[model samples]
Target: MGLFDGYNIASSGMGAQRTRINIVSANIANAKTTHTEAGGPYKKQNVVFEELLVNNTKNLNNNLQETNNKNTSAELRGVGVKSIVENDADPIMKYEPSHPDANEEGYVAYPNINPVVEMVDLIEAMRSYEANVATFNTHKNIDSKTLEILKA
Candidate 1:
């Protein structure tokens, strides 16, 4: 890894966490929504994260040669959002005869979203984002110190 590699990794994590936060917020906002453009209740959305891999053959080869180790092929570059998918779980059906979106059986299909769970997920994402920011700031400070020493 390089000196700036930490920044890239942390920033990617921040981006992924931000995406998660947004998705959670959206799910929370649409928790009570009964009608959507898709013709049903709003579905809870989830952010999927994946490993961000960079093809740095030069770096990989150099490290392998230096260490005389050939077991590892690549390095974990960073994190990224793989996709945003709707919750596959069935919606909660509540008996609300007076509700406009209620079915003929007087059951309304509410989104499969739990407010408490969404709030917890939101807090987790926020904490993860904050941690990534701290990591980025630490890397920045270290780089600044290194440059100052080099100048001297």
Candidate 2:
């Protein structure tokens, strides 16, 4: 691991969380949207995260193993967004005979999004981002103290 691996790990987590928050916000905003350019109700977007381990495949086992050996070259891992997917849950249907987008059955289709769930997701993402920021700040403080000790 490099000297700045801690910072990189925390930054990657923060970036992933930020993207999640943005996506959740958009889902909330479009929760009522019944139609879009895609010709359907707005589908909720979900962020899928993956662990990032930089280096050749040879180092994979070493990274996953517990290291009693301090000199081991096991790299510091980070979080990354693997993909953003649209939820396939069926659209909510409400009876509105006169609504422009109403079906032949006199029901209007609304986005499958639930504002409460989106808000909860938003809070979770914000908390994760805050945690990453705290981690980054701790690393910065440790680096600063190390420099001071060296100067002394």
Candidate 3:
């Protein structure tokens, strides 16, 4: 690990959580959308998070000493958004005979998204983002104090 690796790790988490928040917001915004340019209702989107691993020569050797450790030798590097995917579940079907997008059977296809669920996801994402920010700030404070102590 480098001297500033902690900052990078924390910032990566923040970025990933921000992307998650954006995806949740989009899902909520299109919750009631009954039609889209894709020829149907908008599909709810989700963010997939991935863990980044770093191979630090020294760290790897140290971690390898713990033979019983489950993680082996890979060091946790950062967080990343692996992908954003649309929900494959069937669309919500509603009987709306008068609606323009209604099927011949008088049922309209609404995006299979619930506002309450989206709101909860949004809150979770926001909280995660806040936690990352706190980590980053703590790193900054530690670095600042280290510099102050060094100057003395």
Between candidates 2 and 3, name the one with more favorable TM-score.
2
lDDT of 1 by residue, 23-125 (tens): 9999999999999998999999999877655434333334555444566544656778888998888989999999999999999999999999999999999
Sort the candidates on lDDT, descending order. Answer: 1, 2, 3
Candidates in order, TM-scores: namely: 0.85, 0.87, 0.85
| Cα lDDT computed for each candidate against the true fold | 0.86, 0.85, 0.85
lDDT of 2 by residue, 54-102 (tens): 4333333454554446777555677888899998899999999998889
lDDT of 3 by residue, 8-72 (tens): 88888999999999899999988899989879999999998866643333332344555347766
In terms of lDDT, model 3 sits at 0.85
Each prediction's number of clashing residue pairs: 0, 0, 0
Q: Which ten residues in a row have the lowest lDDT in candidate 1?
A: 53-62
The Cα error of candidate 2 at residue 18, in Å, is 0.7
